[model samples]
Target: MGASIDERKPMVSGFGYASHSSSGIGSAHFRGRGRSHAPFKTWIWRHWPLLMVGSFGAFYLIHRLSHMGSSTSAPKATSQSAQQLRSDSSRVQNGKVRLSDLIGASIHLSEVAAHEITDVKFGGKEATEVKGKTDEGVDEPVTLADARSNSVFVNGLRELFPGISILSEETDPDLEEVGISAINGVELTHDPWLDLNDILITVDPLDATKEFTENLLHFVTTMVCVVHKGKPIAGIINEPFVKDEAAVWGVALDKATEGADLRVSHGLQPSTEDTVAGADKVVISRSHTGSGADVVSEYLPGKQPVFAGGSGYKALRVLEGDANAYVHVTKIKSWDVCAADAVVHAAGGEFTNLKGERLVYEKDDPMISGGIIAAADSKMHAWYVEKLAPLQSSHGDKHRI
Candidate 1:
């Protein structure tokens, strides 16, 4: 007992001293060394981080392993109230997503198809309406309520996740809609309600419209998701026009329908030049509404360049070895990039600010407005980031997250 106490004394001293040095450890409940588990102080003191990491790792491993098993052995559903898929039963006009089918699944274009039976027109007043301002004085016009009701393009997604906050520039309850009725319990309604506890879903109904109107490759919708605590959980941006699943654009339509179409890249590839060499003579905006062109032009000093549509589409171009990189100098709404971000991250490309820092999600700012530098090639990415970092520093206009 004395030996055990002696060994643990250093840890106790360390904790007490650290806490004292920093100030009262704010609402921290030390689990193992508390009164009931006091005897385990020695074990807990040295292994706090290890335990936490191991616990999370174990849970993830178990979740993945259990996925191979049948539903009979799966854990019981927890978020019951939101699981009932209220949107499907209320699918009057179009764009109905059966939430029961989409949650926990990777964001895929086919998932959009499952609800596309509702024939939802993605961009309307719900998408184009000017809603409000973001944190850094950048303008924001998310359509959250419209997503819950009228458009499966957005509303179907709301039905997918239970506690998530989706900031959609289109279909948000904040604005009026001609055909769709609203869902109950969600914070937004035609009456103007607020539910801060739920996760935020920020989306742009139609990204890159100029490209779409001009008959570009595809006009995609931007969708980004954040949990209540302000972390980016997932992102999806689907082509509103091109049924990527119809052809070989994204997944094999046959494979995608079975929920096996999620494409995740490991990390930035070693060389983008060889991969994308001579594939096409054009580059375009991933979103049709069109942005970042002037910023992209900044990268090309004298080249007569081309542009495409949608945030995800741009990132995917790099992954498919098409474009070398994607450079954005302005703040973009979260929904515009979130869904496609999953594809880019899965494709193994790298995304960051000019400083090479990862972009994070925040609740208060509906649009995760910031400049981005994405690359298919590490060397190419590094060169561009290093070159632009100085400019970003000099300008002092880039927002952190």
Candidate 2:
């Protein structure tokens, strides 16, 4: 049969054909006039492995570049972090002076006063006679030790904190020059007034003047307290007669002051047991026996009373665990107890009025009319307060010695 006109036209196939037949299917075609178009399956089969290798290499290169970028910029990020930390540190330093520096300076001044006082022979020809009044409104004999100690503390602290106001038992203007000259050799590097408010410092140069005059060295202490608004923020009690060289110092837990090392390093842990039920050791004034002693004895039935000479010494007994608590019903001078109060309170103990209220220090009159109580811990303090409540009620609004 002869091919028709339709069969003469070319048909599309895998390869371009010069001539084609419309009826042909799956038959060998004529050679293409230009390039051949291979089947898609055959092309993929020939180049599959090469394509995968190229794609993997490109991906690896991109990953390496990303990691390199991060590594190169690491130093800049670290530098910025370091700068932020430094700024935070500077702000904290500007806020307040270290508590250790204040305590150290106070101890140094106290030691100087102690040396001067110890050198003077009590009741000897060289002893200078002076007199002072107690919180009980009684005249007591004061000595050169009291005056010299007062001068050292007042002048040394003034030099230490130039801007802060100072209140001392020795207010003689005539002694100011002598006091300033006495502490001429003291050198302090820290500025206590840097970030402080209008601070008031109360000083009892010799806490137990009568005891100091009687050569009862154990009772004598050089005391200083830092008062802000109406509260004591920091304080020091230095017992010169102790065999070992140590002083008790503490800052209020809520105050911005730093440096826990300034406090009693070894004996900071207070007694945890109920003082009235456990040790039941109570400290009272040796010279001034107040009515509270009987009340305390009745409350803690079998507890023994331990008589002590100085307010600082009695408070020290509680701090050292020699006595579980110290109770004083008589009127007390603020400076007489303020320093000890700070130390006890800082050591996780309590120091408050007999009525279980906190004591305030920024008063025009330095005398504390209410009785004071110090215990190993707040739990013990509460027990004592509960026991003493009836006595307080019987005595009316104010209890007197």
**Model-by-model lDDT, in order?**
0.45, 0.64
Evaluated at residue 289, the lDDT of candidate 1 is: 19
TM-score of each: 0.49, 0.65
Give the per-residue lDDT of model 2 (tens digit) for 122-188. Answer: 4353363556566556567776777778877765554444434677876532223212222222222
Name the weakest run of 10 consecutive residues (lDDT summed) in model 2. 80-89
> What tens digits encode model 1's per-residue C-alpha lDDT throughout 1-401?
23432233322322321112123242222444335655456667776776676567667878888887567532433332334434322321232233212222224422343234124343332233445654445444333223432254443443444444455455333321122233332111111112335345555555554343344535444343333234333344444455534211111111322233333322234246643462332344433213345444554443223466567667656666666676666667665565554445445456676677766656567555446777764676677677666556655453232
